[model samples]
Target: MSSAYPTAIPDPAEESAPTTRCRILAVAERSFREIGYQKTTVADIAKTLKMSPANVYRFFESKKAINEAVVERVTGEIEALIAGIADAPGRTAEARLREAVAALHRDTTGRWAGYPRIHEMIEAAMGESWEVCRQHVDRIGAVFERIVRDGVRTGEFEAADPAVAARCIQAAITRHTHPLLVSQTHPELEPSLVELVDFLLRSLRPAREPARG
Candidate 1:
């Protein structure tokens, strides 16, 4: 599937650049949150880091690069959480799927309410040819695909194509995960989270035998 955002750029930072990049991203995230991204500049981020603009530029080329790094940071956090849930011990696939979807919803909502400015950055990112957003989508989709394949292997789900099922599941929950959609969604107006999971699980269940007279 074509992506709505751009791909991530490979960075080969020197030994100290990693630490410096992290510092720059941290300050840029806060500035974006408190002051908004369009208002934040390379000079502002550098000043917050107590470094010269040239120093910050050494780690990040420009203002756009800094914002992309911050957005990628957010996507990386989501990927980590989804990976952890996918590999959680001793849970049925159904249970794990439910938990993963719930976590996605909560994280999306949290971004909108807790860090509206960061959420705004996400919205802007998705609307453009941002590779980080594309990579984010692919990474998270892979987690769902893995969980669905597990379900099929364990006889918890019956599917001709686990990848297709995974896509459908994510498509079903887009309202809960997409930054722009989540902000406009009212929780009460939608089916309860558990109810949604139950319906999706039913779609994966094996067909029941017909009763005969």
Candidate 2:
């Protein structure tokens, strides 16, 4: 529902260089949120900023560039959240992994409900092989890999290749984390998030011993 400017868009300050780009990105994000990206024009963003469309172009070459920047910003937020969950201290890797998966589901579903256009843009970016989209996937994959690595260190999971496990987990959760895939699900036809996470956790757990007589 709120603006989703790229994390690289630096914080604004008095007479700072990043301030102009920051301002432009802020207005453009808001405009996209208000009017879907497909319907929003660079001129619309310029007028909202009280500037000319030509000036908007000075910072961004075209609408496609602006859209990619916005996508990067949104996925940047998601990537940061994934990193935060992976780094959360004092929790077993299982707890951290569950939280990580849940966080992505919540973010993707929330945005899909409130800012459908952003979700649509992300889907298109994926289809088109956008660089930002690749970066987003790589960053998210890294977080999953971190959690898997931690699990192995803690003896909670038995995996020779954390990278493979990480990729598997990421792919397994696509229905919950991908907007387009999620859109196809029927609430009545699917398991709850808790159930799905429980299944994934089982895969990560070490084989249990038989109970002693």
Candidate 3:
């Protein structure tokens, strides 16, 4: 997998050049959410930001660049949350993994829903940005891999392959984040986010000793 940075941060000097760029980003994010990616345009963002299209273009070269920025921003938030859960003290690997999954679901499905369009756009792009998305997922997978490795080393888990287990954990994590997958199969149950977390943790745990039957 590529190790390059996904989004380049503008110069520090540009940071202090008023809040026009920041305002443009905020407005663009909202416009994307309300109108979907296909309908959202630079003009829409500029009008929302109370700036001319040319001025908006001054900050971002194209709508694609802005979309990349939006996706990068949201992906960073998701990565930070996963990292926090992984680093939390007093939690076993199993518990930490569950917490990480739950936190991801809550953040993605609740507070960060506005950025779903950003993800949709990235998926449709399926080029350079797709690599960025993969790297983002791999970052989360690295956390899961560490948890699995720690579990096996400490005898908390009996998995023979930490990498395989990590991939499974990543699958579970993705399932929780993708509402369509959850809704399509079990429309009736509609499991709470916490319930899904418990389900995933239980699946990852080693089997109990066989009954004496």
lDDT of 1: 0.80
Off by over 4 Å in 2: 1-17, 127-129, 182-185, 210-213
Candidate 3 scores a C-alpha RMSD against the true structure in Å of 6.0
Tens-digit lDDT track of model 1 for 8-96: 75344444566787888888888887788777888888887888999988777877777788888888998899899999988988888
Arranged by TM-score, best first: 1, 2, 3
Ranking by lDDT: 1, 2, 3
User: Which candidate ranks first by TM-score, i.e. highest?
Assistant: 1
Provide the overall lDDT of each model, using Cα atoms, as 2-decimal numbers: 0.80, 0.78, 0.70
Model 3 misplaced stretches (Cα beyond 4 Å): 1-18, 111-122, 125-128, 179-213
Q: How many backbone clashes does candidate 1 have?
A: 5
Encode model 3's per-residue lDDT on 103-146: one tens digit a residue. 77777666435454555464544564666677787888898888
Show how many residue pairs clash in every candidate, following the order shown.
Answer: 5, 1, 0
lDDT over C-alpha atoms for residue 4 of model 1:
24
